[model samples]
Target: MERIELVKSIEANAERILEDFTEILQYLRSEGSDRCDEVQNLLFATRRMVDLIDSALEIYHYLIRLKYLTADTQRSETAESRDRDKMLEEMFRELNSNLGV
Candidate 1:
């Protein structure tokens, strides 16, 4: 697929993951010890989903910065975009320090 199309797919996947994450978080909050095991499994699944979304957003943004995708040709972001970008930057910083690469 073309760069723009690929970016759109990534954005769509990110949005879907965000929605799922929100729902899972709500479930986690309401769950008590009676559901600890089940909640733990769902939380693990949610973490993986979140990681996938984070990775996709990072790649898509990197491509945009590298001129693979144009700035104006993209999906709209929620207010959380800035926070998410900042968090991803921090994560990369931590990883760089740990790997020393």
Candidate 2:
């Protein structure tokens, strides 16, 4: 898939993970001490999900920065190209005038 679509998918998944994590926390809070082992398992799973979400978010930010930097570089190159073209045109005009053309 495209870079933009990939970035959006990562963001959407991260948000869903956060929502699921919230629900897990709420369930844990309402549970009794009888399900200690289950609670522990859930906690571990939630921790892993948190780590994964953090990584996804980091990647999303990096992609966004890369996109902007690429755009800026393209703009700078275009400006340089325009300047070079103008300079060449001026030089040709001077040469033609000298030759009485």
What candidate 1 gets wrong by more than 4 Å, as runs, is: 33-35, 38-42, 45-66, 69-101
RMSD of each: 21.6, 4.3
The residue-by-residue lDDT of candidate 2 on 1-101, one tens digit each, is: 45566667667767776776776666556655667866775776677667667767766775777688678889999999999999999999999999999
Model 1, 6-40: lDDT tens digits are: 66766776777677677666656665566677777
Name the lDDT of candidate 2.
0.74
Residue-pair clashes per candidate: 0, 0
- Give the least accurate 10-residue stretch of model 1, judged by summed lDDT: 68-77
User: Whole-model Cα lDDT per candidate?
Assistant: 0.68, 0.74
Q: What is the alpha-carbon lDDT for the whole of candidate 1?
A: 0.68
Model 1: per-residue Cα lDDT at residue 52: 65
